[model samples]
Target: MTNHTVRPRSAGALAAVLAATALVTLGAAAPASASGPACPTDTIIDGSRLASISPECSFAGDQVNVGGVVMSIPNPGASVRASSAVAAGYQDVPDVVVYRAGNGGVAAVAGDQEFGSEGTLAALRSENSAVAASARPSAVSTLDSAPVVPGCDDRTAYKLSGEKWAGAYEWSYNNTGSPVTSGVARIQDALDTVTGGVTRCGSDVDLTATHRYLGTSTNSVDVTKAGGCSEGDDRSTIGWGELSSKYLATTCSWSQDGIIVSSDIKFNNRAPWWDNTGRACQGKTYDLQGTATHEAGHVFGLDHVAPATHQVMKPASDPCEYSQEKLGAGDAEGLKRLYG
Candidate 1:
């Protein structure tokens, strides 16, 4: 995948829109409750050390926990309205309290920090519900067509000796914060979709096993708090090959690629994201499989197409749309030309 910049709507603006929409549909939204077994203290992001016999060592202690992790206050304060809780500590008096699930683990809440345990729990549930409602398919609108760019074949498309290599390539996922469990499967599916669908290329490209590799390289997809509407993006780069006898060098691996997906965005496969008027599109989230499929196209050498074309290579897509999970005619044509 080549690096192409396509900025989506700002995070702050998107949040506001979602918040307003959520308010209107709150009556119909599912009830949120804080009901689950006590989370492990080891997963909490608290600063205090608990003694072995300390009664305060539990999740119900001073530390706030969510999804089996202790939530930390955001540093430098958050500007987004949704982050009011985490931004409370910024001022002399903590007005709003916000907590994060360590290393952007997709859990965050904001409310009055001084509230009692019951109040805090209620606030957490409300915040989670509002956030969920805001991310619905109806909350997002498609953008205009993406600007055209040079296709993969135009430049170097990660090939060697004028031939796209055919073999199993090893890949690893960054499991530092939110462990890469199901995400790995999503990525694999995307890779297979492109390789198998593009039969015209013969057996020029095939991605094999994805295992746990402790070693670091440019080629990997890691999750972190990337502040933007875009779900994920990747960059494909080239490296120098072996030294030539005639004192010349050739391009080598098209393997130095980096992919990063936003931890802020919730990804799922549930459908019917939007209401009939397309106004109450809550509950539905972005499909990780579909988005990964598109990103994998870039890994296998594909570029962004105009949204009007409805190609998987289109620059942008809404949360509930999964049509891109499979290759479109335009997408297949492009792959055939390059791989064939």
Candidate 2:
């Protein structure tokens, strides 16, 4: 069996202001586990092993399996939200991809990943199976925070694929590292604790990444300056916040299956997971698991946490304001509404 895992990164240059070291709240504690391609051991990738596993997500790692079993983020305009359930688009969840090392071995066979309503998703699966033999992995980034690709098409809804690249996409950490494993429930609890569960989805608006390379690229950012200071006048374009000149921007891309998506994870310099505030952002070096989970919500089509108080998706104004260690009630509702 092949073993694969997700990647990791250090902290970011500027501080977004949410306060919570390990932003996990559900699931049990266990080492990161693989749910795809059959893994007997953990897969490792260095500068040299990327060529062996030929790892691929539904569409450029945009689509991933939940708990290594269920597939998610399978369509465009499907309403991916950030950390808050009160927010309208928070319903969409990004898919999780699994990877493992491949050293001149044939790629392992994979089972069909189904989504949508039972019947709808089933038919789509059958259609995809007919063509699964020829599918290949797209040039999509597998990092937690990827770049945003404009004018990209969602996964085709029914298509099977393959790839020549070989390697596993490792999970930086598992739910055990998180405060909440059941992301949906954790989010709901947050809402009740704060707003008494009265808030509802606000808008069905469309959010586009002004920058490109949603998950893989290091360049393409709209905010921050070249000096990497959070306290410059120009750094206030987005707001009056510190900026980091060396942070790498993420790319956002679409999946061919028309479901999964990708984007970059942004972190504040003051946060615990982020140790540096004035250095460059390298997709290869930084590995903040919690921060990545927060960004994953956005990449899947969710927006920032709502109520600005509860929910992991909310934007932080200060290092202390960021407090979404888990998904709140609002987060769960948003997802069910989007997919269910």
Candidate 2 error regions (>4 Å): 1-251, 255-258, 261-290, 305-309, 320-322
Residue pair clashes in candidate 1: 1-298, 44-70, 85-97, 85-98, 85-110, 86-98
Clashes of 2: 125
Residue range 137-232, candidate 1, lDDT tens digits: 321011112213222122112211111223333444443322223554565566577765532122122223121222323433211121111112
In angstroms, how far off is 133's CA in candidate 1? 48
Deviation in Å, model 1, residue 17 alpha carbon? 53
* Maximum-lDDT candidate: 1
lDDT of 2 by residue, 1-340 (tens): 1222332211120011122225322221112223232111112212122222222212222222222222222232221111211112223222222222122111111233322233333433443343343333332222112112211111111111211111111111112222222432332232222222121222121112122111222232222222111111111011011223222111122223333332222233322332233353343332233234344444333444323334444433222222333333344333322322
Clashes of each: 6, 125
| Whole-model lDDT values for every prediction | 0.31, 0.26
Please tell me which predicted candidate would have the highest TM-score against the true structure.
1
Quote each prediction's TM-score: 0.32, 0.25
